[model samples]
Target chain A: MKRSFYLKIFLFVVLLFSSALADAAEVYYLGGPQGSSQEAAVNPSYSLKQRFQDLFSSLSSIRKDPEASGSISGHLSQTVVHNDIGGNREKSYLKPGVNYITDLNFSIQEKLHADYNFTGQWFLRKTDDPRVESRRDVRLKQVDLQVANERNLYQFGDFYGSFSQFVLGSSLEGFNMDINPTDDQHYQIVIARRNEADTVANSFQRNVFGFKADRYLFKGSDLFSDFRIGVQAASSQDDSASLPDNHTAKDLRNTVFGLDGEIVFKQGLSIQYEYAGSAYVEDEDASEKTTTYANAFRFQPSMRLGKANVRYLYYYAQPKFYTDAGSSMSDKIQNQVSLDYRFSDRVNVTVSENYYWDHLKGSSRTKRTFNDEKYMTWNLLPLASRRSFNLRPYVNYQVRNSDDPGNSAESTTLTGGFDISDRLNAHTNWGVGYECRSFIDRVTRSNSEIFHRIRFNWAQDMMLWARRLYYAITPNVDIRHRKGNDNKDVTVGAGFNVQYDLFQRVFLRMGNTLADTNSASPSGDYVNNRGFWEVDFLVDKERSAHFIIRGERNNYTAENGAQSYKEQRVIAKFEVNF
Target chain B: MRTKTIIAVLLTSMIVVGCRAVTGAVVDRRAVAQESLFSLAGTLIKDLFDNYQDFSMESFRAKVAVDFVSSRNDLVNNAASNIRAAKVLDIDFSLDQVLSDKDLLMVDLKWQKRTRPYDSSNVVLTEGFTQAVFKNVAGQWLLYQINKDNPF
Candidate 1:
């Protein structure tokens, strides 16, 4: 009985959203002057006749100089896939099935008057697959209708609404409007549904309403090239009526108010700041409800000094601060700074530091943890230079500490890597890289580990018999050593890939990889091989077909036991676009 | 188990029917072939720019991989902010080089953009060089990553 109630609510919401489509249809029908004469005769009203004649005259004018443009384009595709697994039913990864899919996109733009225009867009998709649930068979992904002029714009249906990072930023489906009455002033308002009710997930539908206003100044001043200030407000709530009886999520209500500003100077310096306060209630419909009021703020500044660029950031958020439509890291205070300096055209360096901590309220029962990270990068030659030789090296170090009575544990980690590439010629290139990482437990020295890795890559391009061919090979090795057990493990792997134009209309691509691992632990010792081959045939610009085959095998030899498994798959697909 | 068996039989029969239809069809030998891989990769980049200029978020979303990774770790928010910021007045790009490895392609390019902020009348010009990675997902090339900087 409860299920039926939820279903009714869901249907009602669907119908409510569908009203946008219905309105669009009505507009088109009423404007086309193609309505049946029988309706006019039945009405027999003078006003109806006069309206019909007016529409006819308007249609005649449109036919003379339409100033209208539209397009319809998309693709239809069919695919068949088969998968076979051996020795490991639990390891089956891919779903095997046949699928038929269709995608259609249409849009129309017409100039309604001197400085106004009407635009409409529709996107639809259909997928048929017996292996999947039926609920995903067809979907109307996005639809939008807009009426805009030089000073104002209004949108109905789906749109992405954003105000500020900490106030409201999310994709919504409903109505949105932007009013720009002058060059220095702007206003925006949005009312939309954030999420639809999900029966499988047992989650209630969510809705949001928001508005923002901005004022700009000092647009041409030398000291301040641009300065802007804005204020924003947003409220979001979950529909308790749409919640299923067995729902697993709490009904939430949240509202946020924010203020933000930005300043840009003529000397290549800029600063931005934002602050938001939120009031939230969880399980609003329940007797025992939880409520909280909190605030969050962020400040960022960047400057260019000589040949160096510097940037700094500071952020803080209370533990209970929450915004349903925005992003924030709660219960933490963070500070970060970075510098990028160019010594010369061929050399550059970057350095940065970050520090953050949680448990800002200082709860007695909870431990407060702090983290610090430092990083640096130096480049001998930039990658985009495409020089004969390019070298890049970087290092990172981190420290974590906690303040607790009996468990005051601390740890530190250091990591470093370097990459060097050489271009032998226009058609050939080779690169090599190495990395090392070490972790230490300051309180317990026994709990420590060190890891090292090395990799090499080579690529070549050629034209053989007037056909283009390209291939690449990469090999890598990794070693991990632990202090407690005095155990060391190593893994070695190599991969090769090749692409060739077999014919004017056909292309072939294939790749294979092999890996072997020797470990102190029995379960980790294994040898693996994987490969795939693909062929693509192009019938024309709008038609194509693809066939692919893949296979993988794994063998494990350890003191405990020996095991093996194999998997294979084949896929064929054809697609046409119109 | 009964449903699985029925679905298997239906799929097999459909495959058989499809094969017969394909065998009966005729091929057109004079039709134009697809463009080269290099040209195709370049065209994909151009299409990305056009979509951004036109503010076509749906088309832009279609060109991105489902498993896309970003250095900033916030693709959705970053994309939304970019889309809401300004209107592109002019754009110029050059594909400096391309590297192909089976199902993956790496492209290096330099681009310049001129944009007017939504609330201001002044135009801002910015230029940079970046590398982008594309992966072949079901015969469609989708953007996987932007190594250094993301213009959009």
Candidate 2:
């Protein structure tokens, strides 16, 4: 009788929550790295993050004053987390947290003549484990300051620079200056010490120094039509504790010279080209030395019609094109052609094809393992108003072909999806979507795959106080046919998530997902389930308090093998914004 | 053995470097928009050179500084936001026209932009047959308007 009485109270509390909805602000980003209930997974405490900003707002009247030309805004959060992962390698962790963090930007400016801006972030963090001293420290993530005007700009602190498409752009700490004596021409000088971000947890630090100069030449007169050219020379050296990597130690000194240009003959036509040559000198094993050279180049031409933009590109890079570390460019031979068009205000389409001739930096480049891909995609928007009937549709098709010397294969895929939404009233909304994908291969066309998915979403607001509710559910069906047999494999999945604002600043959220797979051949069968429950309470607009619990389970049985895996975790979080 | 070891190290380094490039691309896509906040003049240049991205129509329309023209020009704002990022640092530019006044100035420039990451070199070399009108507001120069110009 006593147990039954307690159950009645529990049921009553659940029934009360059935009428609530989650605060959209706290749950806007649901699918980031840590999955749902982000507060419990990534940041255990951010509600207190608001206190720092509140304290400073009063102190720095300059920050809040409307008359001031500059404004500063940022968020600070502190978290404590306890996590456990259950499986073959079971483990648990306890963290005490970051002492403080600041993502702040401050800027001051004068009239049209000049302005300066500074932005940076800092964090102080530590763990509860006393045995690991290295797990605790204060880290500075970013700091950049710039002063600029109409013709020239100077920058100091942390910044990235690149010359041409491939060479340069290593994150560094230093100074850069741009001089523009004329409107058509400019010169740039860069000097910096490469400050690698990964050095925070690693045993080795690379102290590389870099310097480069770039000159740009162009003419804008109709007599000359269109023209552009860029020339650059850069040098860098690795001046670090050259510790042995893979039982081999080497120090590198590299230099690169590059030139790139473009010319437009008419309104719709243009051509572009780029080339960079890199020379490397490596000193290894005390007295041994080796030298190598690499070259990179690209050529592209494009045309624009009334509704379409078309372009063709060819790129080539040798294995050793990168000196120390490159930012954007890669070592490969590639060719591509693409077109984009807008059929109407509500519809757009894009078609593209890409071919990769070789991966020069891979295990083998001379093997001639070539691959190509073609793609077409369309997007449409048919919505009349934010609260009226709305429709959105998307479709995509792609094909990939590969020739790896003696072996050849091809794959084709097509997918389409659409969402329809309607407003039932002033305070309620409903939406539904359906999507499907079909996949097939050329060599063994018998092995094919198809997938279908459907989802429903809704939100409601109650007139009583500031309360809201949101819910969504999705179901997926997948089928894959066997190549040699008439049998096939099938899997089905369904998941739902709900959020409720129980009070003025408190919320409750819960979600569950489950999937099952069955095979006619009896060699592949499995079931997977995952779920999470959470409660978040807001102290203010920028401060929140939260707790969460999560669990997952997977079981598989087949003629080839049988296995099971399961895990559970709990978290508490706080946040503050200033 | 030495040659093999060298090859392994080189391969590993390349993998790490390659991964960083792709990762940075993803990071840029996911970065908070606050860092790239709007400025009357910088917004246009920001869309052309530095980590270029489309701005909301409201922001573009409101930022249009030309008091004589319609600030809510959806076509201009849309076209401005649609400008693609340069593929490389290759740029050609020339100042073809400029009209100067005490409170306002109009200029016409032309150039070709390539596909590449944000860099000062590109900024210094960017080209397009662009018509930009600047106006002085409280002693600050703001991007007043932009118009299309014939390239040839």
What is the DockQ score, from 0 to 1, of model 1? Answer: 0.02
Overall local distance difference test of candidate 2: 0.47
Clashes of 1: 0
Docking quality band of candidate 1, CAPRI definitions: incorrect
Worst 10 residues of 2 chain A by lDDT: A34-43
Q: Indicate which candidate wins on TM-score.
A: 1
RMSD of every candidate to native, in Å, equals 18.6, 23.2
Query: Per-model C-alpha lDDT, please?
Result: 0.63, 0.47
For model 1, the superposed segments whose C-alpha errors exceed 4 Å read: A1-68, A96-123, A128-136, A144-153, A244-249, A288-290, A362-365, A382-386, A406-409, A443-447, A542-564, B1-152
Best prediction by lDDT: 1
lDDT, candidate 2, B57-146, per-residue tens: 222332455231212122332333232111122223423333332355444455554322111111122334565556668875556544
Going through the candidates in the order shown, the clash numbers are 0, 35
Q: Write the per-residue lDDT of candidate 1 for residues A428-482, one digit (tens) a residue.
A: 9998877777778787886566767677889999998899999999887767676
